[model samples]
Structure formats: structure tokens, C-alpha cells
Target chain A: MILTVTPNPALDLTYRVPRLLPGETHRAAAPAVRAGGKGLNVARVLAQTGSAAFILTTAGGAPGLRLADDLEASQLPSELVPVAAPTRSSVAVFDESSGETTVINETGGPLTPAEWTALHDAVDRLVVPATCVVGSGSLPPDAPDDVYARLAAAADAHGLPSVIDAVGAPLVRAAEAGASVVKPNRRELAETTGLDDPVAGARVLLDAGAGLVLVSLGAEGMLAVPPEGEPVHARLGTPLTGNATGAGDAAVAAVASLLAAGVSDPSALVRRATAWSAAAVLAPLAGELAPGFRDVESRIETG
Target chain B: MILTVTPNPALDLTYRVPRLLPGETHRAAAPAVRAGGKGLNVARVLAQTGSAAFILTTAGGAPGLRLADDLEASQLPSELVPVAAPTRSSVAVFDESSGETTVINETGGPLTPAEWTALHDAVDRLVVPATCVVGSGSLPPDAPDDVYARLAAAADAHGLPSVIDAVGAPLVRAAEAGASVVKPNRRELAETTGLDDPVAGARVLLDAGAGLVLVSLGAEGMLAVPPEGEPVHARLGTPLTGNATGAGDAAVAAVASLLAAGVSDPSALVRRATAWSAAAVLAPLAGELAPGFRDVESRIETG
Candidate 1:
């Protein structure tokens, strides 16, 4: 079983409008609401791929209750640690006319020290039954930067591999804590390490004690950098173009699934991650792969 | 006491962002939330002016619960009729850079026949202690156009005057049901009645059995057209500028307050409504009036 920790969970609302005009009023149909977060998406993808998964997250106020109800309705196994502040909401306005989307994300309130303690304790308890631990998503404002780092160390203490998908200080901390794998998209990689070169940026994570670093390059596929030996490159002959919002999470899910089964080869992880991410691009929405994803791995080119 | 019925109440969320760019993602501070609807705004203004006000509205789902919680926290007296469909949410994005706001309003789910009947029954029960009945706001997509007309007719049945603030067919229906006062802005009036001349358009409502038609003319103030008297025009000497979103609701509150107190003179209602609407413009948010609203009435020009 894989255990996923979402630092900042949200009740995501997607509104569909005929057109999007700046500074104008729009009347839209009721939005599509989903229980969402990076880790939750990863867990969902894993579960969809026939892997048992458990979610550990914090929730509060009315939106939190709605998120809990939605998760239960979707039948995702989870435990929510209650807090005082209401959970944040993410609104996406999809314009049918231009085929574009505009999003607004609420900055969630910082967790209290007691809430943080409860979160760490929840992670400790939930991680006991898992073969792999995944900590993903943004940290709440004023939250300690070592949140995912602490999760990595906890997973290390329990002799389980950990995958950390984060950005900025949290991403560096995850690497420094020696997470088994750290996945970051190209933009996040450049911004976090202040290096425009992907290889040089991945090296920062590898030097910081990460066992492996997976860099998603969108249509170019992925790059895998190991602590020792040469980095591996994997890609599909033809890139799939669709909704790429969940591609990164799908990649992380693939790596975690492999690591959970004790497959740590850099090339093997790269091929699977690339294939699953491409599959994700072909599927509309997030957390699901295309139906023919089985044949994708065989077609992936790795060097 | 005044009874304000909101047919389509909403959990209004306001997000403040540094700037707004079309087709771009924004990071916003936590939204400012309030229980909102035109009728609720009218009730709020009435209460602020020391008029006893009661709210009758339908609520459902999570946002409805939040609306009820917020109303309770603010100490507003309200009775919520439970419905199967969740109440809608309206989002306003305020851009600090350009000082403009973009709004997205969800078209609320239509109430079932059972739900509409329950709303009417709830109104019957709640109207016993009120001196006036006020029905305001948009009708749900599939809602019968006579929702406010029915409210007006019910108010007449109880010998209570009604003030309706609506648009389109609902406005026409309210006027046809012989509402004491029907207030619509110049634009709503022109669009609903298909006449560019405000006086000629208002005449349509008067011919439809409406006792009085009050047309809001933005900075030019308000026009009160009574069934038997010549039209009275009232405007402030100098228009105070601020947020004008809630100005119309404030006008409705003023008229309802006067009618509840047995003051039905067209000139008196016009002066009070003009002053209160101008006071609302000077305030920063909806459901509030500037502190010196009493002095505002004295500076008004009536002709």
C-alpha cells in the first residue's frame, strides 16, 4: 500500500463558461467539484492502477467537510486531521470559446504548531501500513519548509522509500533529507536551483542526498539522474497533447509504484514514468491514464 | 418589521488579487465570504438603520450551511427552508492594480415543485409578524417567473406592502401582481420593458397594476412614478463616488422601511431612497451605509 500526504488539500471547483472576458460578469452553470491536492491526485492515480492507497491530510471548516464527503463518495480510503481554519478552494474557469482555462488558488491559512504536530503524528501512524510514502503539494503560508523533509526522514526511519514532489525550499529540503525520489517539472527545477540547465539542476538534488531525481520535460518526456553513473533519458516517439495538468502527478505515481515494489533502477523508473505521463496527457482531466496505456511502456525509448 | 425573501440566495466569495490577467493563474488571499442575495442586502441595510427585519430564504448543500453560519454569526434573524439543490455561489475577483472587479455567478439549480411550494408555505408562516414583504434577486434558471409575483400576491393577501427588486420577466410579473413598489435600474428597466424612455417604460409597469415604479438612474439619482401623482425626481447635489454595487438594495431598504411605517407618499419615499442609495455608494461594501446617512437626505434635490 502507498501512503500519500497532502500538506494543503482543496475542494477544487471547475466552472465552464461560454467565453472569458476580463473585467466582465459571466453567468455559468454549476461547477464541477473534486477533492484535490498533489498527493491526493497521486493516490488516485495509484488506486486507478490497481494499487492500494491511503490518504493522510488536514481539513477544516465547511469546505473541509465537503472535501471529506466527496472523498467518501468517491470511496477513497482516508483520514482527516481537523484544524481551525477552513480548507482552501481552487477555482478553475474553463472557457469553451477559446479552449483556455483561468485558475485562482486561495492561500490557505498557516497550520498551528499543535496542528503540525498532529499532522506529523498522523503521518507516523498512517505510514506504518504502507510500503512507500509520498508527500506532495504546496506548504501553507508560514508553514515550516521542512514538512516534506520530515516526511522523508520518517519514511527513512520506517525503512520505506519516499517520493517527494514539491518546489522551492521544500523541494531542496526533501532532497537534503535523502528522499528515494524527487520529481519536479522543468520550470520548477530551474526556479528552485536557479539553474537554467536541467542536468545541472537535477545535479543539485542528487548532490543534496536524493537517491534519484526525475525531471519532467513536458513533450520532451523525462530525465532520470541517479546518485552514481550516467543520467537516463526516456520519451515517446510521438508526444500526446491534451490536458497536462495531472501529468506530473501521474509520473510521480508511476515512480512510487515501482519503488514500492523494490524496483529502483534509474532507467526502469524513467521509462515507466515517461510512459505513464504521456498516457496521462492523452486522458482528459487528471488522475487517470488512457485506456491503451499498457502498450505505452513498450514504445518508450530510453538511453 | 420587514420580511425579505431571497429566492436565489448565495454564498458570495470575494477574492482580492494584485492584478487580473486573462488566461492566467492567480494566487489570491483567502476570499472574503458573506451570506449574500439582494433581499439579504436589503434586510441588512434595514437593520443597520434600526428597522426590524426578518429573512426568509432557501438553503442547501455545503455553501448553504456556510451561509447560515455566517448569517448566525452576524446576528441576522433568518429562517432557512431546506431544499434538495445546493445554493449557488458567486465569485468576485477584485484587481488591485486596475481597480476593477470580474464577477462569475453560478446559475443556481431550479427548485422542484415541492421545494417551491415549501418556500411559499415558509413565507406564509414567516410573514405573520411583518409589516412589509420584500422579494428580491434573480430567479433560478428553471424557476417560474412568478416566484416574486407570488410573493407580492401573498403580501397583498396579508395586507402587507411589498417591494420587489428584480429584472426581466420576474420584474414584469412582480409589477402585474400589484406590488407596492418595484425598483429596477435604468438598464434593467429599458431591457425589461423594451423602452428607452424611463417614464414611458415605468408607465408599462403602472399599467400592469403596479402602485409605484422607482427607477434608479445611477449618479442622476432616482425617479419615483406613482399611480395618481406626477413623477418625482430626486438626486444628491453632488454624487459621492465609491462602490455602487449595493446602492440599489439600499434604495429598496429605504422604500420598504417607509412603507412598513405607513409612509406611502411618493415624494417622501423618493427622498429617503435617494439618500440611502447615495450613502451606500460612499460605503466600501454591500449591505452597509455611510455613517452620516441622515444628513444625506437633507442635501437631496427633489423636483
Candidate 2:
């Protein structure tokens, strides 16, 4: 089974209103809460695609308990490491007039040294007997800058592949530690490497020892680069306006599942990942591709 | 014991941000979650004051489960009736720059007919031993508009005092049903009675069979009208700026506790209630007064 690590999980809350003014009272429609955190989202999407995945996450206090309870009720397999700080919550206010979402993400509190160690230990144990391990999301404050690097090395020791999706130092470190795959969105890639071209940015990660690099190009679609092969790019037939909240997580899930299932063709992996990510945007919530993924997948032509 | 009925209880999520700009992303500090609803807030405040209060509320699905779990963790005594729809969540975004709180209250879903009956039958049973029965917050759609009226009558039949805190038609009906007390703020009172004067608006409720009418005059303090005595008004030495979220609930709790203990003097009730409400404003959260309440109470004058 694929193993996913979420150092900072959250209870994602979404509120819907007819219009959102700068300073005013909003009588919103009923709010919705979901299990969140990039890695957790990856695991959820993978499971929906008929892949078995387990989530390793940190949780604490009442909100943490609620997250655990939600996972338990959903029957999603997860290992919750306890922390002193409460888990954070993120809100997405959907404005119906403009059909836009305004997000407010709580900065996750730092974990104690002991808490960080526990997370590392948990990941160490989970990576064993696992087909693959993927680390997604930002590190809690005071956490080691190379947490994904450490995880990549640990998985490397076990002769397993680890997919790393992060920004800045963590992404660079994971690549340096020989990560199997590194995925970054266009802005993240540019901000991290100061490169406007996707191929040039992907080349940096590949040169840093990442076996492959996938860079999301928003409506322009996604680009895939294998260190020793020609780069490939794919997009949908037409751009669609949809909620792209967890599209990246959906892409990582697709990569992990395909890699675990022994899909080594770079072109096929790129096409499927692009279609799945697009399908995720079409769905209302994060972590699952809509049924239209089938049609989207067939129409995605890679060059 | 005091019994509090909350027809629309919620999971109260408070997010603290540096500043909030519409349609922009914000990275908030950690959020706080609590069991919230008008009656539940009243019950929580009363319990903090060393008074016994039991909350009767509807709960269903994940959000409801979280609210109940939070209440249990907080050691708040509550009985939750099962319902089909998930309970709602309310968000309060505190902008640190201006120290302003922007609130988004969700419009709770309608309870099934059976659920409404269950809540009423449960209240009828609890009101027997309850010294005071409080009907707080709005009625869910599909519920009888005269629910507070029926509840007041039920409490009256049990020889118990029924305190109603509501607006619009429910307030009018509760007063007509011979409620022991009805608490309304300046706007709510004016809106309901279409009267500009607080005394005149309170007189309307008193004339409709309410034993006492307490009208919160915002910064002007509070005004009380008793059917058997001259009206009384009390104000703090000077109005203090603080969170006024649960001030009304705090006032209701003070009224309930004093009324339950057989404190019948209108001036004493009005002074204590106004001080408690101001104390709530000084506190960080709803349902509990801060230490400044002692000084505020001593400064309160009823004339």
C-alpha cells in the first residue's frame, strides 16, 4: 500500500455565500468540513482510484480528535501522531456572484522536538513494507529543513521510491536526496528556482538527482521530465473554470499509484496524471476525480 | 436546575488573522472551536457562574459530533437529540489590525418533523424539574413559528419561569404566551415592535403578558421594565471596548440564574444582568466573564 505523510493536517471548512463584501456580516449557507492536509488528500484520492493507501498525520486537541473521528468514520486508514498544539483549520469562502473562493489558512503551530521525532519515527515504521512513500505539504516551524530529504534517504535505504511535493528548500533537499519524483506548480517552481520556463526548472530538480520532475502549468496543463529522456507536456481539449483546490494532491496520488503499479511509461503517466488533476478540479471537493475523468483522460494528447 | 433549549446549535470556529481583505488569501493564527448556539452559550455562561444548567440541542453528522465532543471535553452538561441534517458551523474572523470581528453565521438546515417533535417532547420532560426554561436563538425552518410560545406555556404549566431571548415573530409570540421574561437588544426590540424608544418597546412586551422586559441599549447600558413596578435603567461607569459576541447570552444567563434563585427585585436583576453583559464583552470568548466584571458590577448603578 502507498504511504502518505502529512505533518500538518487540517479540518478544511468551506462556507458559501451569495456575495462576499469586504466588511459586512454574511449569513452563509451551511458550512462543510473535510479531512485535509496535502498528504492526507493524496491518500484519499489514491484510495478513491482503487489504490490502497495509508495516511500518517499529526493531530492534537479537540480539532485533532475531530479529524481522527472523521477519518475513522470514513474508514480511511490513518496513523495519528499526537502533538501538544491543536490541529489547524482552513476556510474557503465561496462567493456565488463571482464564483470565486477566498481562502483563509491558519498557520500551523510548531511541533515540539519530541513531536517532530515521533513523526519521523512513525514515518520510518510506515515506510517499511510499503510499496511507496510520498511526503506533501509544508513542514511545521522548527522542523528540520530536510525532513523530506531524510524520508527520501530512508526510503532509498529500503530500495523504495519516495515522491516529494513541496516548495523551496524542502523540494531542493528532497531532490538532492534522490527523490523518485518532485512535483511543483508553475509559481512554486519559479519562486524556488527563479526560472520562467518549465523545462529549465524541471532540469534543475532532475540535475539535483530527482529521477523525474512534474510541473503543473495551470490551464496550460502539466509538463513531465525524466532525467534521461525527452520532456513531455499535455493539456485538456479546452480549459474549464472549476475549483482547483486539491488538484496537485490528486496529481501526486496519480503518480504514486501509477509508480506502485509498475507503470514506467513516462508518456502514459503524464497523460493520466494531467487528466486526473483536471477531473479533481471538476469535482466540488478535494481528493476525488469526477466520473468525467474517463473522457478527459482519453482526450489528453501528450507531445 | 436551569434547562436551555437551543434549536440551532453550532460548531463555533474562530479564526484570528492579521487583517482580512475581501477575496484575498489570509494566513490566520491557530483557530479555536467551541460549542455554540444562543441557549448553549447561556448554559455555558451560567455554568461558569457556579449555576447548574443543562443544554438540550439537536445534533447530527460530523459537525454535530464535533460540537458534542467539544462540549463533553469541556465538561458542559448537555443532551443532544439526533437529527438527520448535519449541524451548522459559524465563523468569526478576528482582524488583529483593527481589532474587529467579522462574523459569518450559517443558516442552519431545517429539522425533520419527527426531530422537532422529539425536541419539544424532550423539553417538556426537562422543564418539569427545571427552575427556569430558556428558549434561545432562531427556530429552524419547517418548525412551528410559535415554538417559543409553546415552550413558554409548557414552562408556565410546570410553574417554572420561562425566559425567552429571540427576535421578530418568536419574540412577539413568547411575550403573548406569558413568558416570565423576554430579553431583546435595541435593534431587535425596535425591529420587532417598530418603536424607536427602548422603554416603549419594552412596554409592548410587558403589556403582552411578559412579567419583565429587558432591553440592551448597547453602549447606553440596559433598560428593564417590570409589569408590577416602575422601569429601571443601569449603565457601566464607562463603556469598554471588547468582544461583544456572547454578551447577550451572558445577560440571559445572569437573568436565568438570579430568577431561578428567586431574586425578584427588578433593579437588582437589571443591575446584575447589565454588569454580566458588559463583563462578557471584556472577556476574550463568549459565555464567560472576565475579572473586570467585579469592578464593572460595582460601578453599575440602577436608577
lDDT of each: 0.91, 0.87
Model 2: lDDT of residue B147: 83
Q: Positional deviation of B12 in candidate 1, in angstroms? A: 1.5
Model 2: DockQ against the native?
Answer: 0.45
Best by DockQ: 1
For model 2, what TM-score does chain A reach?
A: 0.96
Q: Enumerate residue pairs that collide in model 1.
A: none
lDDT by residue (A61-116, candidate 2, tens digit) is 76788789889987989999999988888888988898888889887878998888
Give the number of the best model, judged by TM-score. 1
Worst 10 residues of 2 chain A by lDDT: A22-31
Clashing pairs in 2: none
Question: How high is each candidate's TM-score?
Answer: 0.90, 0.73
Tens-digit lDDT track of model 1 for A132-203: 999988889998989999999999999999999999999999999999999998999999999998899999
